[model samples]
Target: MRPGIIDRYILRYFLGTYFLVLILILLIAIVFDISEKIEDFITRGATPREIIFDYYLNFIVYYGNMFTSMIVFISTIFFTSMLTNRTEIVAILTGGMSFRRLMVPYFIGTATIALLSMALAHYIIPISNVRRLHFENLYINQNTGERYSDIHRQIKPGHLIYLENYNPDRKSGYRFTYEVFDGQKLLSKLSSDFIRYDTLTGTWRLDNYTIRVIGTDGDKLVIGRQKDTLLEFKPDELSPSLYSVTMMNTPRLLEFIRAERIRGSEKVNMYLIELHQRTAWPFATVILVLIAVSISSQKRRGGMGFNIALGLALCVTYIFFQRVSVVFSTNGNLSPLAALWLPNLLFAIIGAFLYRIAPK
Candidate 1:
């Protein structure tokens, strides 16, 4: 059976209205944000072009990607409710078209949105985030003095690394430790109380260091006064930074997870959670879209106002669950995959139940 021109018209209207409202709301948000931060940019000696094109432009796109799920839900609710209110949905349902068939176009549109969101979040917007964070650091000066703490973890195969203190400003760490293990045995350990990088040499220098080598029967602890080790890692790479976490692509994230797991590091939970959340979050857009469509397809006495309120309540509840589940995962109480996706599972179930009972 062929869908009439009216069906195509309704699809275009629904999708166009959805994008138009979303862009308008986001524009208003950007204006308010720019007004508030304009002074800070000026005080920091930022140029007008930099303020407008560099920062705020990327800011809007980043935020839009972050709240794409909300946009999908609100758009679905608004357009579906409008159709029901005008009796278009009723007419289509009564004219030999099943509700399932009527939902095909909606599903197609939402699936496209979800795929785009997934691609941007995982690949594209993250590149913009690097520049955005740099703008904040340079012009905003948000992280001038706030340096990252030293990370002491195993980096290479059978080698354990440590840093006593790390400063992002200096791009170096102090008091580093590197050790190697061989078949449930201690092979060699390098300890340094002061690990400083030589800008001229482009390498790290170890002051007042010691090398301890374990023998077959007895271990010999060798002490050295000063030395330079040719390790492959840098201080800034090991130190924690906001952008350092977000800058990692999916493959880099997976590599970090694997390395951290081998070293038995406890702080790797957040990285693992973020890696899984990126994929899991896109599916949520689809889930929320289904729920919104089902809830708003029936005309109520309160009309669109009632549907908006209902949609807000559901969206808020979903966000709350998502945050709570993340907390559980961070605390290691729940598996990363399970915690990240628990919100989608519960809401998808609710969507299914509502769909079954929705007005035909």
Candidate 2:
């Protein structure tokens, strides 16, 4: 067979199997999701059109892109193992085709899927998630209220703000305190009995406020009534929803991260995790394909069934590793880049080793 024809043939088979596997898996997922949310749909009066268009359509895009890499790896293992079982790989190898050359078609197929996955992740999926999440909020989940007690945040470096009780509906808080610190020592402190956002002036209206400026020698205290001062936080920012960062697209997420850095938002790591994962996953999928080909391309007694089970196990392990690394980044000291990409880096080494040892 001509190399071009064989490459095209192999590439076609890879892509076809990928879509076939993707559809079956997505359908199973949708069935389970619908069963779980059926009661919510009925009680919340979710129309069929809304269900199909707003929720599941966007649902497929988000969830499909999320698992695209895993599916591609599975597809690679399935098809390559079938070729090995059928002895097509043996024929091709004996017919002057090198093992490395055999990888060309698989690499092309995987690169195609990787680029599509990357596009969906950074550009398309976030937009889809917005509508999907909105539909869920309206029809399934409705917990929109934010934090109401003991709100603490750093609006900037060395600047701390606190509120005992905050009301998002009213855009105000009670028992508000603002403090300025210099290294280990407190420079000044401001306390308020009641505070309300002044929409007209874009500042805070403080009631029964006290200002204490600490000097090296002594502390100066001033008590005032109805003080007006500009604070960095917006009204909505007081009770930021934890998962709100996932809704923004790449550009918006970057801008928000920049603003949050200036505001010293503590949840910046979570946002960074999402940001890094988007680019990281597509590249990781490429590594996964290399591993898949190395393991599945060899003929063995167990055949395709063995490859399939082994592929599933490896995919699960990789995903679990990814989730754990994300936890480390968000909850532990690991930086987002290191935590997210570390799995890929480790797996790449494994892939290289396997590819080097695979039968030629």
Candidate 3:
């Protein structure tokens, strides 16, 4: 349906204010980030152009999506409070437009933002994170060492690999073992003192290795000084940092989660939380818009300040609850779906309650 004049007016103001607020918040974040990292950039001899285009460009996208819900709430509160002050909302309501009907344009505006946010979270952000994270690791973290220890994984069905220590820089491992199993029965085992990945040959070179084959009759053992073998796993897959999940887009993330589960990784819960959060975080935009309109639509004695303060308070509470729930999911036995979504669900109910009693 073609939008009427009132709907168009409200949508135009809402979108204009939303983009303005988003830009302002991102600018403030970039300023603070530069302040904190200026010394590192200077010490690393990072040029201004590189800093602007390479670092802050990706930085803005990351934090912009990160804080979209807060921006939505603030924008909605600011614009709706202005409408209340000007008595535009009162005029519309007096003209037989119900408060529920007034929400149509707001919902449309928020849905647009929410869809954009979801797309960014699931696809664009992760691709940008590759460069952002690489830049930070080289210039900011500056800690280059072994990222994984005592690693174990099932690279494929019935094939297990273990490493006592892995050095990502050298692409080598010490005390490596590979095992093959058949329905809870050991088929064969390969142990090596040291294993180095031969990038030229795309294979693994095992030094001072021993292999044992198990059969119905007995175990057959073989020893060798050096050997080269093809393996299903790669060095990169074996040594991922805790934050590696953030670098994967949705499809890669799903594949990683499946592999991690097969490898019996305890950190799979964190990945699951991240997966659920991509969608859940964006959906909060709608909830926050409803809450903001409910709280800010009626002009009070304290005027816009009162409504803005209340909205900020609620936003803070929402963030606090979200963090607490994530901690529960990560540390406790809480389900990731429940932990990531509980805040949105609770606030949605609050929005409904406020909507019920909001001034028409």
Ranking by lDDT: 3, 2, 1
C-alpha RMSD by candidate, in order? 2.4, 3.2, 2.3
Give the best candidate by lDDT. 3
Q: Return the TM-score for candidate 1, rounded to 2 decimals.
A: 0.91
Using alpha carbons, what is the TM-score of model 3?
0.92
The Cα RMSD in angstroms, rounded to one decimal, for candidate 2 relative to the true structure is 3.2
Per-residue lDDT for 100-216 in model 3, tens only?
889999999999999999999999999988888888877888666645688888878799998898898789989999999997998999999999999999999999999999999
Each prediction's TM-score against the native? 0.91, 0.87, 0.92
Summing lDDT over every window of 10 consecutive residues in candidate 2, give the lowest-scoring window: 236-245
lDDT of 1 at 273: 79
Number of the top TM-score candidate = 3
Query: In candidate 3, which residue pairs clash?
Result: none
lDDT of 2 by residue, 155-207 (tens): 77888888999988678889999999988799999999999998999999999
Better of 1 and 2 by lDDT: 2
User: Over the stretch 266-352, how does candidate 1's per-residue lDDT look in tens digits?
Assistant: 667787777877788888988887788899999899999999999999999999998999888888578888888888999999999
